[model samples]
Structure formats: C-alpha cells, structure tokens
Target: MTDTTALSQTETVQSKADVVQVTALTGSIGAAISGVRLTNINDDQFVAIRTAFHEYCMLVFRDQFLSVEEHVAFTARWGEFGFNKMSPQLDDYPMVLPLSNRGKSKAVTENWHYDSTFMTEPPAITTLSARDIPVGGDTMWSNQYLAYETLSPGLKAMLAGVRAEFTGTRLAKLYGLDQVPRCLHPVVRTHPETGRKALYIGKPGDTVPRFEGMTPTESEPLLRFLYEHSAQPDHIYRHQWRNGDLVMWDNRCTMHYAVHDYGNEMRELHRVTISGDRPV
Candidate 1:
C-alpha cells in the first residue's frame, strides 16, 4: 500500500485479529479506520480498534453517524463515562454533552485543551460526533508525544519533576460559575497506556497558570514557551469536519483546538468521554 491515504502494513497484533484497516491520517497523530461498524462491533473488531487507539492517539471514523445511545454504548467499552461538570448533558442522558454553535457559551472549547484537565483525574478519551458542519468549523489536534520528544534535553530535564496548576478559569466564565476547579499536575506527564511522556501545559494563565508553588510572574516565560512549542505544524493535524463523522482522541496524549470561523452558520456535535486515572 502507498503512504498517502493508507498505512503500510506492520507486524502489529491488530493485523492478526481481523480485516479491519487502520490507516494513518497524518504522520504524527491520527488514523482512520474501516471495515467494522461501531454499532455492531465484534470482540475481534473491538480488539483491533482498541489496538489502533493506543498506537495512534486519535481515530477518525468517517460516516459513522452514531446515535446518542450508540455513542454512549461505544464509550462504555473503553471505561466509565466522564461527565461534564459545567454544561448540562443532552436532555435526559447525562452522559452525552452537546456542543452547538447556537450555544454561545460553548465557545470555550475554541481554545486548545485536553478535556476536563482541571479535574484531579482528567478523562482518558473524548469522542465527538459531528453534525451540521459549517464551511469553516475545522478542528486541529497536536501530538503531545512530539511536544515532549522534540524538546531540548536541557528543557526536558528541567521540567521532569515540576508540576503546574491547571484551572477551569475560561470554562468557569462560560458556565457563569464562581468557584472553578484547580489542581496541580506534573509538567511532563507519562501516558499510562503508551508509556510516552507529554507536555501537560496549555494556554499558560488560562487553562494552566504557573508552576506549583511559584508566582505567575515567575513561571510565565517558560510556560508560554512550552505552550507555543507544542503546536508546531509538523506535529499537528487539522481535521475538516464532515457530516456524521466520529473522532475519538486520547486526551492523555493530545490537545485539540476547535476553530470558530463558522460565524453565524450552524455547527453541532455531541461529545462523550471515558474517565481516566490521575496522570503519572
């Protein structure tokens, strides 16, 4: 197979499972899968999908168009559901969170972030089902593995034992809340599954603010550098949304940006997350 649209076969265990194909979308982070439907996935298919999920931090299932119930059922196979604390879930089902352009407050997701990072135990996986995509509402994801791996030896060594304060400031404002959640997480965290390290900082004073025990003024420069360095073009993939698209990413190893260029045009997505343990 050629390298443009599909992945060259490798000696991975998933190759032994079934005919399901895992095609790498970008050189860095994502892959597209085919052959097995999420609604009727078999044990062998599930094994193949799960293997790809670990090997590639993000998986894009084009034209899946899963219903809210089906989306919840698929997420259940990964782990316990990670509920949103700020936004109310879709009507009756508390596990399905809705993000629509009509919801003015949903703009908080426009920034680059991992889901629920302020929580002591942030989510591991986040699944989004796209609908009514406008012309320019594309989303971009970056590989944190590259962010950590490409850092200078000196910088990586400096960040080894440091922790930073992650806060829900921007989200709190969107939700009209007073008390935002905050927690300290290692500046460089190891992904429990892949055992790869990632830079855990986001937009400095916004999502994360200062290193633990240091004043914001002191931690400003380095934190800013890491955030800026992490999104270099080679390590990123900008996903143009399509109707009925399903994208699931490992929150532990990737950070995503939701573009707000759609203006007044309509865009809708339902999100489901799988709970993860505290970062190591």
Candidate 2:
C-alpha cells in the first residue's frame, strides 16, 4: 500500500514535471499558474511563483483543494498572518476564515477595495481557497498601478502629498459593530518590495469617507471619479472561480470586488491574509 501511494505521488508530480507554468490572464493584472501543487512546492517553484505574483499582482491556481492547514502553511510563505477582526475564524484554525454566503445579509465586498485598509498595517497578500463554488459568482480585480500611471501630471502632482482616510464602515455595518476601524494612508502608496506606486483610493462613503483634513463633501466628487477610473475594463481582470481553485492577490496593489450573482447557491471559500508594512 505504501509503495502504491508513493507511486501515485510520483506519477502526479511526473505528469506536471514539477515546474511552475504561468500564463498571463490579461494584459493588466492576473496570471494563471499550473504544474506545481500548493501542498508541496519546492524552492525553485516558489521563487518563480513569487516573481509571477510581483509582476501580475494576482494568481489563480486551479485544483488546489487545500485543507485548512495547507492553506495556512501556503499563506505563511508570503508573510506573517494578518488579522481580520471583522471575519470569524475556524475554531481549530485561527488563521483560516471561512467566507460563506450563509446568513449574510449583504455582500460588503461587492465594491472594489483593498482588504483591511482600515488597519494601520493592512494585509499585503490574501489567498482564497475555494471550498464550494456556484456558477456566476466571479470576482474582479483592478490594477492600481495602472490607475496611478494613467493619471494626468497635474492630478498626480496634486495627489503626491495627499492622504485618504479609510474606514471599515461597510464591514462594520455588516458585522453590526458600533466603532469603526479607520486609518490614514497615502492616496498614492509606494510598494515596499516593488517600489511601484499604486492608487490607494476606495469608494466614497463606503470605505473612504474623505481625504485627510478634508470634508466628505469636498472629497466625494474626486474620490468617486478616481474609484471609477481605477476600475475601467481595460485595467481589470475578472476570475470565474472553480471548485478546488486557490486564488491569491496583492492587497497592497489591487482592489477586488466579489460578485454575488450566485444568490442562495451556497458559495464558500477559505481565506488567509498575510500581514504587511504600513502603507508609506
């Protein structure tokens, strides 16, 4: 039986050559990775995966089917575990949070925004392992680097010294919390590892109520425009999730929106976020 199991594992690795194969999903943001399993990735494969992640900002690994322990282990390769006080975790695995449609009154993630931006030190990376998936429940991600790069020189100059106030208003409301978590981050944040700048704006009155030192009314119009501009079709990649898929994104450089079209269909995924430095 042990020999047979060993043979099976060898055959599985041999079939895929144990090499990482990355294919760009779009011209802008995401990549689809194949050939290496998340359960047992080698040093070379990890280097290649990390390189692709830096270039693409998001990655999709199909047929991962990772267990809670496997998910946490894979996420730790990126960094320390980032806390999400708003989401409940599994009793056995504190770092793994189950994202389900069960008893959810509304989908707070339907808007394009970074994960846990209200935190002083927000998550740098977030990975979701699909447990159950329903048709029509695709998630979309926008390229924030392109969002900043495409702006006019004058607008860029004006925003160079600006900071925005990010609040956990939607998440707070969803979780029925009285106090909202909030923080101030640069409007255009520089990536610590890549040294690239990304627009860090969120939807007005949703996650970002206003720019620092500015009233909500004064910040609304420009904030709305920037939010809309960042989410243009040319700058986005939409992922149609499949069961057993593990998708990870750089929360520092991308904004994601979860589509709730699969209503009452019981879609669920396990999430693990990696902590990052405070946005500069």
Candidate 3:
C-alpha cells in the first residue's frame, strides 16, 4: 500500500513548484516569480503571490506585459485603486497613470522614497508594468524592515513615539506644481499584517523636513543616519527591467529608487497603487 501521508506531502511540494516558482533576486528585498501570469492566475495562485510580496517586500513577474486594462484589473484584486496626482490618467481608465521619460529633464524617482507619503492614507502596494524599456532605467528596492531591525536597539528605543514630516517638495518642483504637499508619519511604523517594524525615513531635507518640531539642527544627524542606513547596498535589490516585466512592492515597508542612465530614449511604465490606511 502507498504511504498516503508522505505521498500527499510530496504532491503539495510539487504543486507549489509547478504553480509558481519564486526566486530571491537579492538577499534582502526583491524576488522574481515565474511559472505564473498575472493576467491569468487563479485565487490560490494570487494568495501565494500576495504572500510572496509581503515576505520579500517586492515581486518581479517577468514577461507579463499586460494591457493597460488588464493591468488595472489584476491590481484591483488587492483593494481600491488610488489616484496618482502626478500624471494625467487614461480617458477610459482613470487608474492607469503613466510614468514616462518623454518630456522631463530629470526623473522625479531618482531618489529613494515611499510612494505618496504626503497623503494621510498612502497606497500600500504599488505595481509598475513595463511599457517601453530603455537600456539603463533600472529600479532598486530596499527592505525597511531590515533597516529598522539592523539598527542598534538604543536608537530604536530613542525613536519610539517619534514622528517625521514627509513632503512632496522635490517632486512638486519637478512637476511644476504650485504647492507642495506634506504630512506627518511615525518614524518607525509597524506593519499591520506582519507586525514587523519598518523605518519610515524619507529623503532628508527633501521630503523629511525634521522630526516633528525638534528643529533641523536637532533632527539632521539622526535623520540622515537613518536615511543613509536604510539604503545600504546590502539592504537593496536592483531590478533591470525587461520589456514585459511587472514589478510590485509594498510601500509600507520598502523604499525604491529609479535610476535613469538611459537618456533621450523611450522609457515608459504604467503604475497603479492600492490605497492603504494611516501608518500606526
């Protein structure tokens, strides 16, 4: 007689490898997922994908070049789609926002940041679907959970109950917006799902003005350290995007940098963010 218990375990492991294969792209943050298509995935596969997204903080699905409509549809499964204030939305699909390098002197995403932090409720999961790819417009993501974990416990204790100011000054200037938007968020935010703490420092002197009323002089040294430390090379994974890649990251626990070494060539991408609650 077949040992059904051992047989079931073997089948389960095989099924997982068959359904989706997630390979870590870096020791710290991003993972590449194969054997599944975003446009054509079942609920069980999606659950596995979401689990992988949270575990790795970012998931890169290669060759998913989904249509604009299809991209919006797949992302909507996560939650309500947030409006992207930086660009004009597609006429048919309001959620489809473009991130093209067609008319800009510099890309706003060159620095590391959490998306839409100026809002009280910034989006949680941000998915970017590659439209057009230049040779060197790679993006990098860092794990903020590791950033906070690796910090000295003394510093962690000191940051308790600390809040920082987040602004859109640089991005607003890049887009020629009239007024910059800003908000206050905890310095160390706890993830709602995983219960892990993540350092929420923004680009110093840019988005993060100062630790709430502590003055620039008081906050500069520590804020700069946190910012610099959170983005250490060992804490990051850089993605050299392919023509059909679809990458998604958790904004609550990751900071991503968009590198623009490709000049004057067409580099386009579409992004949709799922609304997240206020950081506790």
Q: Write the per-residue lDDT of candidate 2 for residues 152-260, one digit (tens) a residue.
A: 8899999998999999988888789999989999999999999999999888897899999999999999999999998999889999999999999999899999988
**Cα lDDT of model 3 by residue, 1-280, tens digit:** 3211111111111244347777777767777878887888887788777877777889889998899988998999999999876878888888888888854466778888999888999899998999899899999999999898888879989999999999988778877989999899999999988898999989889889899978978889988999999999988999998888989999999999998788788998998999998998
Relative to the true structure, how large is the alpha-carbon lDDT of every model? 0.85, 0.87, 0.85
lDDT of 1 by residue, 87-116 (tens): 888887898988888544468878778888
Evaluated against the true structure, the overall lDDT of model 3 is 0.85
| Stretches > 4 Å off in candidate 3 | 1-18, 102-104
- Model 2 segments more than 4 A misplaced: 1-18, 102-105
Worst 10 residues of 2 by lDDT: 3-12
Between prediction 1 and prediction 2, the one with superior lDDT is 2
**How far is 44's C-alpha from truth in model 2 (Å)?**
0.9
List TM-score per model, in order. Answer: 0.93, 0.92, 0.92
lDDT of 3 at 139: 93
What is the C-alpha local distance difference test score of candidate 1? Answer: 0.85
Ranking of candidates on lDDT, top first: 2, 3, 1
